[model samples]
Target: MISSRGRKIFVAIAGAAVTIVALLCIFPFWMVVIGSLTPENEIYVRGYSLWPQTFSTEAYKLAFEDPGKILRSYLVTVGITGAGTAVSLFIVSMCGYVLQRPDFKSRNFFTMFVFFTVLFNGGLVPWYILMTNYLHLKDNYLALILPMMVNVFYLIIMKNFMRSIPGALIESAKIDGAGEFYIFLRIVLPLAKPALASIGMFIALNYWNDWRNGMLFMQDETMYPLQYYLYRLLSSLDFLKSAAASTIDLGDQVFPSESFKLAMTVVATGPIILLYPFVQKYFVKGITIGAVKG
Candidate 1:
């Protein structure tokens, strides 16, 4: 064992290292907050500031001048994120369980099939055609939800995690006359929480942040997800203001484009910030276990 001096030295070095890393991670977020709150004139005169010289809510005001659409977008995103994560998690868990079963023949073939999709794919043109023409998902919520429901990488991780669970558990359940579905529901589902939570968060984030599908398929103003709406606002601030000008009276106020972007960044990222901490332990553990599960 190390002596007291060595231990103290180690602690000092570790503390300094962690503080540095923490600053690196947090500084950008702090800047986002500071920039969002800073007055537009302050930003124009002197780029970004670590701390706002003049605090103002003009950014948030410009963003939410028409709160109806923003609220609708929130509803759309929340609905999809919740529904997609639940459905995707259930399907992925079942797939993982099936692939882990010792007696399951053709599991190798199916695994290869799944993995092959990851390595090569039809071009975006064909994929877009399939989604729009055949699936007819254009101007639909399914366009955003269905394409990302399963990830090959997450499925393989789940398979490994399930495999590492002792076979005796399955054998015991079988001996007790539990049906396959029953065994999966009562036994496997409860035990797979860490892996489930990990992949579930990933799926949720994907659905929450998805905009490309909306950009590609959706044409209706009512159907825009939060990210997609914000994306349009970021792309063309003048268009946003001009469009809103008729509905809401801007009066003498200018749109807070710079600060508005930062504000949108905060709003778009808020839920994940609240969410990730709670699942962080499970996420880290699940990844570690999967990596070494063989």
Candidate 2:
């Protein structure tokens, strides 16, 4: 057994390591918040500040000057995130449950096929042409949702977690004459909550952050997701400049290109922060269980 001195040293080292990592993770976000709140002039002169001398809301005002656009983007993003996550989770969980069954034939072949996609992929040109030409997913919500709805990595995570479920539970359910679907819905799902939550969060984040589909397929401002809207705002300096001209008097208010970028980061990140606490409870157990191999 280790003595008290050794234990204390271990604790101290671990605490320092964690503290450093936590700061590294948190400092960038803190800067984004501070920079968003900082006056444009302050950011220009001083670069990003941990603490600002002067605070301003002009950036936010400019962001929301197009309230209709922002609101529509918010709705689109929320719809995609909600629907995509639900459908993805259901598909992933079903595939996972089926693959974990010992009685299943062709499981190995399918699993390897799924895993192969993870390692190699058809080129971007083919993928783009296939989605746009063959599938005709463009100019629609399906364009956004379909691409992200089923993920191989997430499927594998769910499969591993389901594989760890006791075989006796399945046998007992069978003995009681429960169908596979009934047993899956009733028995497996409840036991797989942690894994589901973990993978569900990943899927949600993907849909939320996805701007490529919007940029690629969506010509309609009405269909712009929040991330894509924010992307457009950042890339077009003239838009930000003009937005500033309309909102704040040009002489008094500086147009915040630098600060606007940070403000966009702040706005884009707010929902994730608000939603995280709800799922934070599942993270540790879900990540741990999913990490363990069957």
lDDT of 2: 0.83
Estimate every model's Cα lDDT from 0 to 1. 0.83, 0.83
RMSD of model 1 against the true structure: 2.9
Which 10 consecutive residues of model 2 have the lowest summed lDDT? Answer: 239-248
Question: Candidate 1 lDDT, tens digit per residue, 1-294?
Answer: 469889999999999999999999999999998898999888988989898777998777766766676678889999988988999999988998899788899899999999999889998999999998998989999888898998888888889888867889988999999999999999998998878877787778789889988899889978998899888877886745543424556568665568878887787777778877887887777567667543
Q: Which stretches of candidate 1 lie over 4 Å from their true place?
A: 1-18, 242-250, 292-294
What local lDDT does model 2 show for residue 52? 94
Q: Which residue pairs does candidate 2 place in steric collision?
A: none
Quote each prediction's TM-score.
Answer: 0.86, 0.83
Question: What is the C-alpha lDDT profile of model 2 across 251-292, one tens digit per residue?
Answer: 654556887777766777788898788878776665676665
